[model samples]
Target: MKRQRNRGRVTLASIAAMCAVAALPGQAHAADDPAPYAFDPEAATVRGTETNAEASELKSGSVYRSAIKPGQKLYYRLNLDDDTNAYVSAVAVPPSGGKVAYGDGITVSIRDVDDTQCGSEDAIFGSGEFARPIAAYAHRVIEKGNSTCREAGEYNVLIERKSNATSSPDEWDLELRYASEPAVKAADAQETEAPENWSSASPVPPSGGQKRSGGSSFYEATGLETGEWHDTIVPGQTRFYRVPVDWGQQIFATAALSNNPKSTEYLGNALSLSLDNPVQGHVDDTTLSYSGEPASVALDPLPPVDYRNRFASASDVSAMRFAGWYYLSVTLSPEVAKSYGDEAIQLRLKVNVRNDPKASPYEGAAGIFGVSDEDKDMAKSGQSAPQAAQSDTMKLVAAAGIGAGAVLVLGLGAWTLLARRRTAPAAVPAAAGGQQPPYGGPTRTW
Candidate 1:
């Protein structure tokens, strides 16, 4: 019976492939350009309301998709208990090549029924003045004897987009996430503070590793481990990758832009690399000017992940309080296209995650606060979520070809080859230069 079912699947797949190939000749090929943002396909669509009375309810441990026009204030509702720490993050993605000012960005805040603010955060375009995805999160922490925002029954999440006259008037897409972390057991709760000192030395750059494609947004970020990885980025493009950061682990990463000897034009703020914590909180970022020569940017060494880091006054220290997926965003300035052409540039990442996993003090399940074996496997596979799907699709196509006759199989093979050529990015020649040490700068410690 099992063999019969397998055979039935093969036959159906073969028929589907044949029909697809028959229509391939006249189908228009999609452009190599990716979308400005890749929202999770399974995320629920939500609409935010202007007043709290009509606000949509957001459940914990779920993802939602929404949009906000310029100068609009949207509100969403949340229900919480006194023992769990609730967090709400909003990521705003502006249109590529759109006009933006330095201060243009988004703000998020969490408030109680009495209008007492629990927490608020804002993210901006900064000096780059380029349109890109920016994330900000608001969290409600449950302290033992806190006064404000305590005993939460009903809360409101407020999101607003700040724009100026120079910015684009089009609506910006938003990705919203709500997560709750349970409190530690009473017996396990202990007072802890951020580390006062840590290593300030810059890490050595890694040489080579397997090539992987980066995703366009956090939802589709490629999974990476403690190793060297490589990718290609075109001008005006921003790529995102994620790493599983366990408790007690410290992550150090550096991004290098390969030299382009073919073009020696200088561009300021040509390369940027930014890091965000598990809760989508900004940790640290660095930028470097490019002179058509090899240049790199390295994130300052951060303290190991500790639950008590949240009590620290430093932004960077507090941002590393959670132990989950950490995000890395690398972007190239659009002005590079004017000097170096539209060809993709080589991007090499040197990532080092230190320490071992440690036990948490949560009373129950950690709930997205720690890494699992499956997360490690995904990183080792060196494929993004989308790429993994593509691989499965190709395997199914091959199986279908084998089940079909020789004539149909030959046609399918030709179609596969053509599709690859159409989708692959054009390769640029390697820069002829010796290894250059990371651009020297003041060492920072948090």
Candidate 2:
């Protein structure tokens, strides 16, 4: 192992040098499926326990059975949350109480609680599998018999019934036992992986961050009866906004209703408030949309409410309950949309698309939040703060590793020849026939 260790160090040093050189930009190509960065544990753990409420006690009809071999220990755990002497009461019944009277051919033993708070108890029944049904009360005979449930058979184990003379059964839990080789655990089952969910709405280009600009155009607010219809610029499907030459800059527009704030009802609330720009890229590019349209409406920042909007339906007052101004920011890509020859580019946004009332927590929120002053500075400077920090750490680690490798190679090369010289004299052993080899002289050894 010592020799192997030294050889491994030599090989590793060479590989480290190669890796360090590759760390330089353009020296190495990107790799697919990088090594995992951390270790995660996978084990089946009993996450505490639960019990039935007083209204629904573990009924008498509830029954469990076990098939065991001789000398095998069966463990069944019961959780008693509110009962102090619960374990003693449950252990008093015999498994075959409903069967024969004399020596029901079963044994029972109640051991101490396990280390866990759930308090597990070990009950060893008959010696062979067909050990008669030993009720909980037969624990003493089983202790004396020193036999085990050996053969395989169904032994109906029951939760103790409530006695009219004594108090009724309170809350409790039960854990059945199995004596055999551990089967394929649930943790080892195939994992269903889901792609990461909208990872914090990262900025486009993931480095330069983003810049926002706001502009306004003619917004005509129209009213209708409770169940009436209008040509309604239905900001839902697709509505266009005219941007004149003066509004030349990148345009981001939003809509809101100027109405009295209400708390609890879903009526007379804001409806489809969207804007469209022809010269801007599809607002749906980032999945930031409202009701299938390239638009969105403000959402509750705290415990958000459900919202749904259509042409002329009940208002989603949940969207407008908060007594404050709600603004929606629609990001536009001015360069791409200009290709479509339109004098005044029109952009499309959707405030509501469906009539369903299922609301999203992410709704009602305009742009993202949580950016610090430093983040803003980095964005303005066109520098990736996270990437910069990662690069610095990687460079330091790579540099230190390279330095260590160089020292190791130099030291090993110097010590290699010296070690050979020191071990040279002891390289040879007399022949197995108890005689020195005839041609043997000073041999070079390592």
Decoy 1 TM-score against native: 0.80
- Report the lDDT tens digits of candidate 2 across residue range 1-446: 56557668767866766665544421111121111111111112222212212212221112222232222223344332221112211212222112222222222333323211211222222111111111122110111122332212212222322222222222222222211111122432222222122122211211221221122211111111111111212111112222211100112222322222222222211132322111111111111222212233333111112111011122222112111112222222112122321122223232221121222222223111112344334333323323334456567767877776786777677678767766655667765798755544455334
Q: Which stretches of candidate 2 lie over 4 Å from their true place?
A: 1-5, 10-48, 51-293, 300-400, 415-446
TM-score of each: 0.80, 0.20
Local error of candidate 2 at residue 245 (angstroms): 38
How far out, in Å, is residue 268 in model 2? 18
**lDDT score of model 2?**
0.25
Give the candidate number with the greatest lDDT: 1
Error of 2 at 213 (Å): 22
lDDT of 1 by residue, 230-302 (tens): 8888888888999989888889999989999768887877877889877787888878789888988788889
